[model samples]
Target: MVSMFRAASVAFFCVLSFAAAIAQPVKPSATTQGFHSRARLIGGGQQGEHWLAGVEITLDQGFKTYWRTPGDSGLPPRFDWSGSENVASTEIRWPAPKRHEDAAGVAYVYGKQAVIPILVKPKDPAKPVRLALALEYGVCKDICIPANADLSLDLNGADSERNAIEAALVKVPLPQALAAPADLSILSVAPLAGDKPAFTVTIRAPVGTKPALFPEGPENWFFSASHPVDGDHFILTVEEKPKDASGPVSLRLTLVAGDKAIETEVSLDASDLPR
Candidate 1:
């Protein structure tokens, strides 16, 4: 009887321990000194046209964070939303990041506190939307530290916070043309010779300054790394990823001139830019 009672007690203790583990909440590490993160809904709880979700990160006194493209070193921030419902789609609108040089190499980042505005569209506007974000990011000072946070927010109704955030997002700066009155006129698009399909785009710009072109789609693709050929105008040698060739796609080009910014949009066939 004594042995049987002892075995029963051990089984009960095991079940209690498992229950405790399940009850433990997942939260951001408190040991880290310099980094902080928060998420909030912008504008009021009204499902108005669209809702903007804001994610802000503040680095510790001496620490820094990485950009989408961390350059040579540092890990990019990861966001997971497995628990999010009522969210039809999520779009992350990142302000242009800055380049930073360190002992290891140059890195791109948004310093101080960076606010990333996300546009969320709900499938059903009447029902309240609940959003749970699981985010992991890396911060570096003398050494690198990984931090995480589980952020939750609800869309109650239309409000002022949402309006303020939307306003600030609208004022974010974009790239501009280097020359005065520089205009980007799309001349034509045509296919290039190769088994791997590609498109060549001809654009007109003011003489002297070389304007850089970037495509808005395919978040995995980086336009800055692709070199633009200079002649009487600018020509972009672009290749479409296999699955992206179904129909027309909108392309946005940003021309950076010191502190000035200019942007233009064009629509092109997804198959390839026509010759």
Candidate 2:
């Protein structure tokens, strides 16, 4: 379902723990059919072929978590991977998130446990691999609490467990393939003259559907509470914080209908209007 929640303001507060004793080795925490995370490594058959590492987070029942862009009031999860070797880089691939509303505000989160897939590339093919991750996420009930964990996995060589994890990861939703045909366009973004800096985003989509709009970054500067003028357009008000003036801004729009979701990225100017 298309959710009315905006993705910019979700609160995902993370506290860092670098002390060796504090930073435990990364491993899959025992599964309890509740909110949890898991990781595995895949690939290494052919020389020069990169290996992909996948991490899955399953949210427990009745509990909701924030999206990369957690709407107005929730904290989005923070991922930190420092002090590791032999790994080239890591990229986070988010599945299509569901929209949720609470007394605090609207948020986009996974209602059930979600498999968040990560791509890991190694520097050398012949050596054994050790992957480490320090992940912190905010779990919300009536009150929200920040959670942290340091997870590790060893990819000595290609194995069945790795292959199964990779296979399952692919089934998770990815941003819509660009090649697929769809009718959605970002029409315009313009500034709203007000005490707080605000902007209106004009979008065009199928006549009767609500499209999910998420601001990419500059987190605290924008509010997710949007005013929809009609089926095809909406106006979003952004706060003009001192820090927002320092960088270029962009917004990601996720439009969903039935089981299909399409994402479009739009660049915004310093004024919060379309560039």
Candidate 3:
């Protein structure tokens, strides 16, 4: 009888501990300080079977960081998660960034603070996930400086920062089909015939809303920032191309206007001239 009672007590305590873990929120990782910035790992615990996580970076006054494709200059943030434990895969979701112009040229960047949301899938949902990040990025103002941060957090429960993570996610550009929205979208893309290859991208945004276009392509291809031809028309000239590059290049374009933004992929063929 005593043996059965002891077994029941052990089982009850195990259940209680597991329930507590699910109910409580995990603490954020220690802040890692670098040049003009500080970073840390935050979590939203488990949503469904996957975990919600983030790399929160705070920048000093007048310092900014680059996006996935930094454009003319500056290095994008590189994340290394080899030090993590029980993690199957991780995806970093980037929020919409603003266009920054410096002597170097046009670049996409985030100002003040950047909370990059991460979607983490664990090897086992029932077990704890230890997330570790070795982050390397650049901070620029008068001068650009490379920065590094080693951040980590153990995700075993929900966190208060989940609301923050959700807010950041709201800023991420929604992927849309070409010409999807009637109010704001890519109206047309026309190939420009010239000694130097170029293309014209026409965008439509609500009246009085100035729109900005960001174009990204293969690493070998370099494109000039969109130049406004008129209210809704912009031209992007090809600055450089690979020695053996061909036409019909696939371009990833991000369109931003005020608080609204959308990302879409478009293909431009050198032969597809205006009708």
Instruction: Report, for every candidate in turn, its global Cα lDDT versus the true structure.
Output: 0.54, 0.56, 0.79
Q: In model 2, which runs have C-alpha deviations exceeding 4 angstroms? A: 1-48, 83-85, 156-181, 192-196, 206-209, 225-229, 243-249, 252-254, 271-275
Question: For each candidate, what TM-score against the reference?
Answer: 0.55, 0.69, 0.85
Poorly placed runs, candidate 1 (over 4 Å): 1-48, 158-160, 171-275
Which candidate comes out best when scored by lDDT?
3
Tens-digit per-residue lDDT, 1-275, candidate 1: 32343355446545643564465466533122324533333434444566767666776566677655554455567777677778887777656555566665445566666666777788787777776777666667755555556676776664556655565466344544323344544455455575544556565555564544444445432222233465333344443234445577665654332333345565557654332
Worst 10 residues of 1 by lDDT: 29-38
| lDDT for model 1 | 0.54
Where does the lowest 10-residue lDDT sum fall in candidate 3?
1-10
Candidate 2: RMSD to truth: 6.3
**lDDT, candidate 3, 1-275, per-residue tens:** 32343355446545644554465343335577767898888888678777999988899999999899877776689898998999999999998888988666788898899999999999987788999887877788976666667678888896879999999999888888877766778877777788777777888888887788888888667676565568787887777666666567788888888778888898876344322
lDDT of 3: 0.79
Q: Which order, best to worst by lDDT?
A: 3, 2, 1
Go through the candidates in order and give the clash count of each. 23, 14, 0
